[model samples]
Target: MESLPEETSSSSSTTTSGGGVGCGGAGEKLPIRPPIQPPSEKYSPLDWSAYFDQESDVFIPESENVFHVYTAGKEGPVVFCLHGGGYSGLSFALAARKIKQEARIVAMDLRGHGKSSTENDLDLSIERLCGDVLAVIKTMHGDSPPAILLVGHSMGGAVAVHVAAKKVLPSLAGLIVVDVVEGTAMASLMHMQKLLSNRMQYFPSIEKAIEWSVKGGTLRNIDSARISIPSTVKYDDSKKCYVHRARLMETEQYWRGWYEGLSEKFLSSPVPKILLLAGTDRLDRALTIGQMQGKFQMVLVRHTGHAIQEDVPDEFAITVLNFISRNRIGPNGVEIPGLRRPMQSQQ
Candidate 1:
């Protein structure tokens, strides 16, 4: 569901002590790397204390995407923003725009999604995509540790977990996971595969492409009568047919590996957090098959859907604010029972 991120040329990197998690190849097995010391102090801790002041504004973006990367808020702590599938940093623009009034916000267009690239050639693996996020943060830090917050939704949420677990992100003030779970890596892979198989056939023109895309997909559920076209999707006039502005194919690969799984060592690392689920989620626990073992807090978004931001942004925003107020750090947060729909909800 995401747009494409511009393809980045990777720097040569060999596993080092505390080199963070190993980047697994597509359909390739990854070897474990030993944990290393934090990066240089320049990148060690982010100074979040200053951003709390009101009157933050958007600065020029630091990325090279089709859309501008929004950096807003005052001089204080920084927060990196990650959006859900098929969307871009624009998805968080509205909410984070407000948060900017109090702190700095750096919202990223996930690689291959949202203005990064134009191909729907998606790779839905967790490991690579998660690495993309960390790479961006590292680029921003330039070898400095500054305190910051991460607001990740759905797929973005899973990426957040894997990054935070690495403990390589210095001065991460807090983590806010929006409606994501451990098994998400697996679920996203299946979802993306079906989506790609069904709608990936490209059209000669943009109009025809978007037309066909609209006929299928979660887009049909938009209830056009009430829902506005999400910012994530926009018609590309230059092309006669609609083309996903995001890179669909590479994204697919990132999530594919994710579902296969990331290192278990990270599950315990992301603490001081919150989880927002939708009351409407109907995933079957039995079919999920695996057991959810660990600790984390969970809250249902009253009457929301899988895309909490799109379905009920207000509630989602409120819950996030509450989590920020109640637990910025310290206790990490609560681990709710694994998400599973009851027989009744299914009916």
Candidate 2:
């Protein structure tokens, strides 16, 4: 195993510009509108049991927040997934479905997003997010923990880096960071902010929400968007409309320093890591294929955007599986024998 780096200074600030809308794709022009207020009547809690094979909430007593976790597959190495900003655990639902038979998949909705409870303000911090992830790992593994793999996207990728840097999970096998990297450009960050800022807070119907999502250009994969958008919203009894469950303002505030912090954490991580970059040009050029050659593995998924898994589910799953198989360390932190799978050609 690689040794962790020494503790470093806190993250630095970056200049930000605000203009235009949409995450990475172009969309139709919509009328400017104010955000919709929360409903007067309490929201009807979503019953995900019917949608996912296993859906349950794990209460983190330390933070006093209940994290919604969705799991599939009865056995194999545990694969814990963390979704990006404004997304829920269901963001990985499609990919999870494809790899469930090979691994026990667990995806969680971070605090203030999806079905997770946002009861405390402490839940919004990066440290607390790392704590929540550790609690889940400890709870799931119990006395005998197997080699675990962490797969994260965007903001969640930062959280994963922090957790790995902390060295909390003794059974941790590898880290797979999607799209996000150490030196993300300010322009890209500003674009994401504009995209979130321009999003409609509520929709009159689920169909309308899907239509708006498609027109808004937040997601490239229409099928993935259709599944994820509905999962991120809940019907409001009083308003008779669907509203987003994520707290976008709070998330965006923390995202300002997320990249810098992730850089620090990445430098200190001891586990084998894989950085998956979308083949799009919108993301800033920071770390290159030549730079990470021996330190860590990097793969570029051609023609995909920030949401690599959603944009190319099968390819993403195969990439993850290949990485895990290649880096399957045992409980004592030694390489596992006779369990490796043959590598498939990269797409």
TM-score of each: 0.58, 0.74
- Per candidate, the number of residue pairs that clash is 86, 0
Looking at model 1, which ten-residue stretch has the lowest summed lDDT? Answer: 220-229
Residue-level error in angstroms, candidate 1, position 286: 13
Compute the lDDT of residue 300 as modeled in candidate 2: 83
Q: Write the per-residue lDDT of candidate 2 for residues 1-347, one digit (tens) a residue.
A: 12223334432332123424522224444444443323221122334443357888887655567778998877777778999877888777778767776777789988778788856633467777887788776666664467778889988888888877776576677888888876663446768767666779778877667656545655666567666777777898988899876767656666666666565566456667788887545333335543354657778887666788877888888887787677764323334222232234489
> Model 1, stretches more than 4 Å misplaced?
1-68, 117-127, 184-188, 197-239, 247-253, 262-266, 280-294, 328-347
Q: How much does each candidate deviate from the true structure in C-alpha RMSD?
A: 23.6, 16.0
Model 1 per-residue lDDT tens digits across residues 1-347: 34323335543444434434454444343554443422232122222223223222222245332323556665455667787676666555445545665456677767555445412325446665666677666655655535567778776776876777767665665677676554544655557667666665545543333334334433322222012223244455665544555556555445544433332423455545555666425233531232244344556665444556654554655665565566543222223233121223335
Shift in Å, residue 45, candidate 2 = 16
lDDT score, candidate 1, position 130: 67
Span of 10 residues, lowest total lDDT, candidate 2 = 37-46
